[model samples]
Target: MTIDTQSQRAEHSPLRRIFGSVFAILQTRLELIGIELAEEKDRLLGVLFLGLDAMMLATMALIALTALVAIAFWDTYRWQSLAGITVVYAIAALVCALKARNGLVNSPIVFEATLAEFEKDREIFRKP
Candidate 1:
């Protein structure tokens, strides 16, 4: 009579099966999260560079146009036009700076949604 030891050894314990399944799920989720992060980073970087380039080019164009305008009116109102532009831009800068300062000072808390979810989880866990 032959012993059936091979079949017993081939069968996985329940704990091992559960642990393996959990590990596989965690690994897959982590891989998916990593892929999503990479995609988001790539997209943000592309947008940032494109926006910066466009803004820089626009600023240069504006400066050139301002110079052209001043040149066109050089004989009559060159200094006056420059002075008017300077005052307008200075006021705009001051307003923008004040708004930025206020925004930085009064910004809401970061990760608000995550904090809310964490509180909910804590409440659920605390209930038993």
Candidate 2:
């Protein structure tokens, strides 16, 4: 009975070790995915807040400047001044929108490191 038990354990040991290694690798990959997700979320939030603040301040400034320009030209070129300001604001808005679209389209793939790590794991396991 003692000899049989020793043989059984010896036969199962390699399987157990393989399973342990696989589980460890899986756990590490999961941790890396979690970390990447957190970083991406923080970055997106920061960009959102900063963009909102910039838009808000820029709008306030534009409104104030528009009022000042209109008041300054109230006698002679009031209409032309307002129309020019409107045209300039429209062009600026279009440029900003295009830049934002390009930024989103060109942004790096999310979880790139996690994908690379998974690829490495696949390569490691594929070896003979």
Candidate 3:
């Protein structure tokens, strides 16, 4: 009787290779996701810290500057100067709001690369 070990081994090789490649692709995708998550976390933390610092410092400066201006021009331009500052602040706030809105509208959704990869996979698997 002939032992048919070579054909038996050959029959399984392609299946084993396919599984191995799938696992490798999955691992690479997961690693990409992890890297993106870390970057987003860092960006969020930095924004929070910077925003908090800006708010606190700005509050103190605005109060002190307003008092100084009103006191310095107690009789002549107190109201005018205060009104001007208010207008400037309002304009700044509006500009910031618009910029934030635009930023959100333009930003890419999360896992964009992974989604693209999955779509490519789907197309590949669908081909005859």
The C-alpha RMSD in Å for every predicted model, in order, reads: 6.3, 1.3, 3.3
lDDT of each: 0.73, 0.97, 0.86
**Each prediction's TM-score against the native?**
0.56, 0.92, 0.71
Model 2 earns a TM-score of 0.92
Candidate 3 wrong stretches, greater than 4 Å: 1-23
Model 1 poorest 10 in a row by lDDT: 1-10
lDDT tens per residue, model 1, 20-79: 876765576566566666766797699789968976996797799789879988999999
lDDT of 2 by residue, 31-82 (tens): 9999999999999999999989998999999999999999999999999999
Q: Which candidate leads in lDDT? A: 2
Candidate order by lDDT, decreasing, is 2, 3, 1
**Candidate 1 collision pairs:** none
Q: Which residue pairs clash within candidate 3?
A: none
TM-score of 3: 0.71
C-alpha displacement of 65 in model 2, angstroms?
0.9
| Candidate 3: 10-residue stretch with minimal lDDT | 1-10
